[model samples]
Target: MDMQSGTVEEALDKAAAVGVTAVVQVGCDLERSRWAAEVAGRHENVHATVALHPNEAPRIRREEGPGALDAALDEIAALAALPQVRGVGETGLDYFRTGADGIEAQTYSFRRHLRIAKEVGKALVIHDRDAHQDVLRVLREEGAPGTVVFHCFSGDAAMAEECAAAGYYMSFAGNVTFKSAQPLRDALAVAPLDLLLVETDAPFLTPAPYRGRPNAPYLIPVTLRAMAAVKGVDEDELATAVAANTARAFGCPPPR
Candidate 1:
């Protein structure tokens, strides 16, 4: 909701009315992470994940000097310990946006976030974009946390199977509904029902019919329905599975 025009409270209200039992708002930087934590604190149905995004890593290193990235990681580690913080992420590799010059910093930041997630005993939410092999390599090397979720999963069936084998959760976002995303849909089909999740990734990746407009939690049903169709399952069944999977992924009980 931070990306949208309305207040967090209003977003929560709309989400609840539309059958969204809970929402996990992720932070891409220290300031936004704090804001997410504050929002989570104010709403029972909301939770947060704190991290420094891969793209943000290089910028911080360049703008704030070399050691500044370490300082920011320390702050992220501290935030991960908060009760309202359920995960440490939107971290991981993003070679598409970070470029070769930033890869080193991104890798370092990703490793630190992974350690923090394990240390805090929280879920690790990853954002792998065009750097899947490196992301998997780091996870294998460092050993992933008890719960790992690839948020906005952008991989093929083989990759989905690999993640499933590693016991990772694959979260499909609104992009899954796009006609050009048949490969993503194929991956969704191969993903085990027990390991499936759906997200809005709003106010971005809005589902079709409303693709160009701003997205919010209430629009999750649009993505969920699309996923269910791709998986050849009833919408309600998929909804139930997603709820259970989400709770498991975040290491939290489903909201009453």
Candidate 2:
């Protein structure tokens, strides 16, 4: 299934309990990244990523540092080289959250990931919040390589069009299930089905009815059903297509 996008080990373990053949783990910093890598290496069903989210940008910028970014980069590089490491991100811009060294620092971190993902030839999981315009600009400017999945795609019709045209895979989260998300539903209807993906973004963005509860891969069906409904297709067909798209994008093929 998918990794727990959290800092604690207990959460990651809980995510593994989801009824999936395997689970991927996302790591936000150096020590945790290393620990994630170790866990993935040891567990047959676990994989991980070494990423520094845009929200974490302030820590790097605010710290009186001579080697903050460099150190993070070095550790991420080491993680990337690990045989079990399968992706390069969870990185991108976040204009929604306000804080010190916000956009500028997010831009810096995003640019760095673009370069690193290109260098490593691995898939990327992008996170853009109210920064779709800038995120597309930097991705194009830097000439990002490999597959790019825009996780938690909150974009409306037009932004979905832009992302679809760019060949970026769009991953809809449980938020797409809200009754008020008709705009997103319409966009999904128009977007090419093969380019679409679904995620729970656990343990967050739990689908409606399950909202306010900690999310997990087991909750993915809500988003999937909503997406299938958007495309006016049966759930199984949509799942089959998205499975192919996800495997292609992330290099994690479903079991035979």
Cα RMSDs, all models: 0.9, 3.1
List TM-score per model, in order: 0.98, 0.88
lDDT of candidate 2 over 1-256, digit per residue (tens): 2234454455445544543445566666666677778888987656677788777766775774626876787678768778777777678988778454477777877888878777778877788888888889999899877688888887888988888888888988898888888887877877788899887777788898888878877677777888888799999899888878877876776733
lDDT of 1: 0.91
Model 2: lDDT of residue 195 = 90
Model 2 regions more than 4 Å off? 1-19, 64-66
> Candidate 2's error at 7, in angstroms?
14
Best candidate, TM-score: 1
Report the lDDT tens digits of candidate 1 across residue range 196-254.
99998888999997988888898999899999999999999999999999888887789
Candidate lDDT scores, in order, read 0.91, 0.76
Q: List the residue pairs that clash in candidate 1.
A: none
